[model samples]
Target: MSKKENAAPTTHTSESLFGKVNYTWMLIGLAVIALGLLLMAGGNSSDPAVFDQKEVYSSTRITIAPLLILAGLAIEVVAIFKKPKA
Candidate 1:
């Protein structure tokens, strides 16, 4: 009985660093970033001499892609800093 009284307290912790919500947000951010990067790709002309200004300067690639990337980054930051509710 004395030995039990003197024993150290038990502390159980999760193996993962972040909770499920954080991981979910991280995954969403990664997907959004991937989509942005994919949108920024393509528009390559086979002939180097000939350039297609319209394809390279499309609204989706120039505007939407960057916005998506920024949104993803914001989400990632939020996910990293967000605390799990008790």
Candidate 2:
């Protein structure tokens, strides 16, 4: 048989890649935003209306906020690049 006649069969799936949004990415983005907000909230805000304000972090702990934020952003970006596990 000629090589052309023995070509591998290609299966066509009845779906478009752009048809759906990857929920994993949406979840990751939400988690990241939440974490970043939480980290930023760790420190005391200058609003008395915002009660339940306790300083769980200090000048030294301030580093944690940025770290968590950066980590969250990184995770979100990775999720975006990853294919949906389904």
Top candidate on lDDT is: 1
Can you write out model 2's per-residue Cα lDDT over 1-86, one digit (the tens) per residue?
Answer: 99989999889887634213555665767787687668666654677576542454454347766776777777667666766545
C-alpha lDDT score of every prediction, in listed order? 0.89, 0.64
Q: What is the lDDT of residue 26 in candidate 1?
A: 95
TM-score of each candidate structure, all chains considered together: 0.74, 0.46
lDDT, residue 11, candidate 1 = 97
Which pairs clash (backbone N, Cα, C closer than 3 Å) in model 2?
A: none
> Relative to the unseen true structure, what is the C-alpha lDDT of residue 28 in candidate 1, on a scale of 0 to 100?
98
Tens digits of lDDT, candidate 1, 2-41: 9889999999985767889999999999999999999989
The list of candidate 2 runs beyond 4 A from truth reads 1-22, 43-61
Which regions of candidate 1 deviate over 4 angstroms?
1-15, 43-49
